[model samples]
Target: MKAATAVAVVVAVAVTLGMVATLAEAGDNNRVFQPCADAKIQRGDGFTFGIAFSTRESFFFNQTQLSPCDRRLSLASGANAQLALFRPKVDEISLLTVNTTSYPAVTNGGFMVAFAGRKYAARSLPAFVSNSSYTVTSFTLVLEFQKGTLQNLYWKRDGCASCSGKSNFVCLNKQECAIKTSNCKSANQGGSVDCSIGIQLAFSGTDKHDAVLNSWYEVSNLQQYSLYGLYSNLRNSLTSQYNKIF
Candidate 1:
């Protein structure tokens, strides 16, 4: 009887430890993917642009979640969402120079602010490339605010293999075309293209909130213009501004 009781006690202790370990693992995962809950915006505050590769056609649409643009773009914790305007070749033209009169206002606590048009790039390259075609396939930009502490910023880009109505013909990035011989056969198919970047915002006002904005652009060909380079320049400029403001 004594031996059985000792075995039972040992088993119970092991089971409790195992449960604790499982809970700890779950907590760690949550911390890593923390969902943005408090992020909100008014309807006209957010806009999206979609472009078709074949026809080089584009269309703009505004979010229809009613006024106050209280829709949430991200469910991940510790994140906020806003609309941004992205220009690929920013060095040639300044984002700040654009007319703000056309921009829509974003409301916060009865205060409205316009979504500033900004530049973003994935990497750095020459400001100009001769004898190359420049086309803007698709573009998306976002602005977000995080209350309290500022943390790391993240961005992602996804591509469709049949974007151009051809199988595996449209390469999203320069690396994708280089990897496959078939993809590189045509200049339109395999060119280093498609890039994105994110910027961290500085803390201001009584809100104690930090802002972040990210932009992504898709080009059918990378050899034409260095979209990544343009994006990089924009990122650097915005980062400098945040440094100065914060």
Candidate 2:
């Protein structure tokens, strides 16, 4: 009876170890995406923003698409707020260059831009991996901005000629960038000016699976602590409400 009991104990231990190994494998397959390091901004005659990310698994994938007016960041100084908009072209904007050896090739990419309340929103195209259980790491985003001209100007959401609804104009010049909105028809006129600004952006992909990804605009030469504080307050308020319900 002792020998039989010993044999049964060995069998049970083997089964338990097998189960643990399987569970660990499963856990490894579903690892979440890690955040990239905070981007560093350098200011001179122009600006450059660098972003990075990392993953453990070999079969990771990541893709980022940016559009003109897809992301906006704002800064508030007491009663005044400064907003910056990032707008990349839909077809020519290449933010991420994929490495076929390290990561699976990207399938699709593009960008779109829009004007919102006191801000311009830029959006990136969706990114995903063809296979599961892969982690993408060490992705980078580099954006270069200099002075250039933007033409064929028109109102973002309204017909330039009709001017029946709300009207706003965002103009970028050599010295400064400005947005003006007015309710009167006289203010709705559309024209192009010599904008001494040029912008270029690039990004890479990761293995995480999110259908839509958003790239926030980085505001240069502005202090945005107040904006961040307000955002933190709003997030905390929502979290508190959720906790109360749960």
Candidate 3:
């Protein structure tokens, strides 16, 4: 599988990680690193989520989702469910920039956010792109997923970010990511443009990356915790951005 798909698969596993959120965040990133490790968390704390893409015809898709966002955005197939979480501890990180160069090296808690392709490119408010200067786009966050075994983690949503290019080029820095518009294109709306939903962050750090990953099991259980955090972070990001724009 391609790197994006592999990581996207990681996002799909969030379903299982729902039960493992408590295990992953009991105290540090170290606790939730094992692939088979259980989150021991509960539903509504660390689960998956879905966001609709903008109306097709938004020109922002060109630089964001890596696809066209000019069509009838599909619904996030499994989005009916989502986890509920509060803010994450992103302020502590030295360089939380989501760039092509940095995203590959992210670790601890970066790689879990994604969106649908048929509708929005990465279908979140903060990440949406627009061509019009005044047509500022914002985020629209949904609820969080329930914590439990990832029984429903592997299915595609109705309006999921299609794996056509299977990669989103947009990246966000901790500081500017909040203000950043989801619209990558100059036009706020376009036609047949696909939404985007892919890795928000990823890392390859050692066990010492954070207070969470002290144990080897933490490293091994990557999918469980990472998936929960990914969607959780996305919802937070979108909510924050929506408040800012409105």
Candidate 4:
């Protein structure tokens, strides 16, 4: 009888922990997406950002498809668009590279924007990720923080460094390095190009303790983090265990 009670208690603990994990995942998922104009950031908290992109004409709330910095974008039916969500620490430097996962493909003449925090936080400019002619794959983002609060998010151009000397890429106006849309997987019937975007992230300004921070040097020292793979493995493991237990 004593052994039986111990087994039961163990199972109860496992179930409770599982439930808590699920709740945490729920909060971290897409629900974190908030309008850049209304996002709120606080010190010692995770900031999940949203980047909406699409190739369709009507996906945007307006004809211009202004950057998230300027207006709120509406994701409606027949929009044929997708939003890529990610969270990175503002107090540290990191490298993030993401490819199309379960989300719809980003194709033909699409722009994207980054948004975080409320009132005091600023969103990035509307960046052209892909066009009918080309698609950009490498980018550097700078997140400015003041007194532990997020201030602004912006993209730092690399002067075509990623595109130079590559046969598949073209240097546009000596500022952007991009590949022909015909080589992108979605646009080309037999193309092998992966339109993955690499974000080299850096942080500037001070933290809550008023200590200056620079993410550039730190990010340069570490390898890229693959959050997608970690999430997938965890979810799959949980699901497998759940099915076996129940």
TM-score of each: 0.20, 0.16, 0.22, 0.63
Q: How far off is residue 33 in model 3, in Å? A: 8.1
lDDT of each: 0.20, 0.19, 0.24, 0.50
Candidate 4 — which residues are off by over 4 angstroms? 1-45, 55-78, 101-104, 217-246
lDDT of 2 by residue, 4-88 (tens): 1111111100011112112223224322111111111111111111111111111112333222222221111111111122222
Per-residue lDDT tens digits for candidate 3, residues 38-112, read 332231222222322233323234444332122322212222112112212111111011211111111111112
Alpha carbon deviation, residue 208, candidate 3 (Å): 30
Q: Best candidate per TM-score, number? A: 4
Q: Which candidate is the best by lDDT?
A: 4
Cα lDDT tens digits, model 1, 1-246, are 111111111110001111211223321321211111222222112211110111001111153211111123111111111222221111011122111112111100111112211121111111110112222122212232333221212222334432334332335453111122221112333433221112211111111222322221222222221332343443332223222322
**Candidate order, TM-score descending:** 4, 3, 1, 2
TM-score of model 2 vs. true structure: 0.16
Query: Looking at candidate 3, what is the lDDT of residue 12?
Result: 22
TM-score of 3: 0.22
Q: Model 4 — TM-score against the truth?
A: 0.63
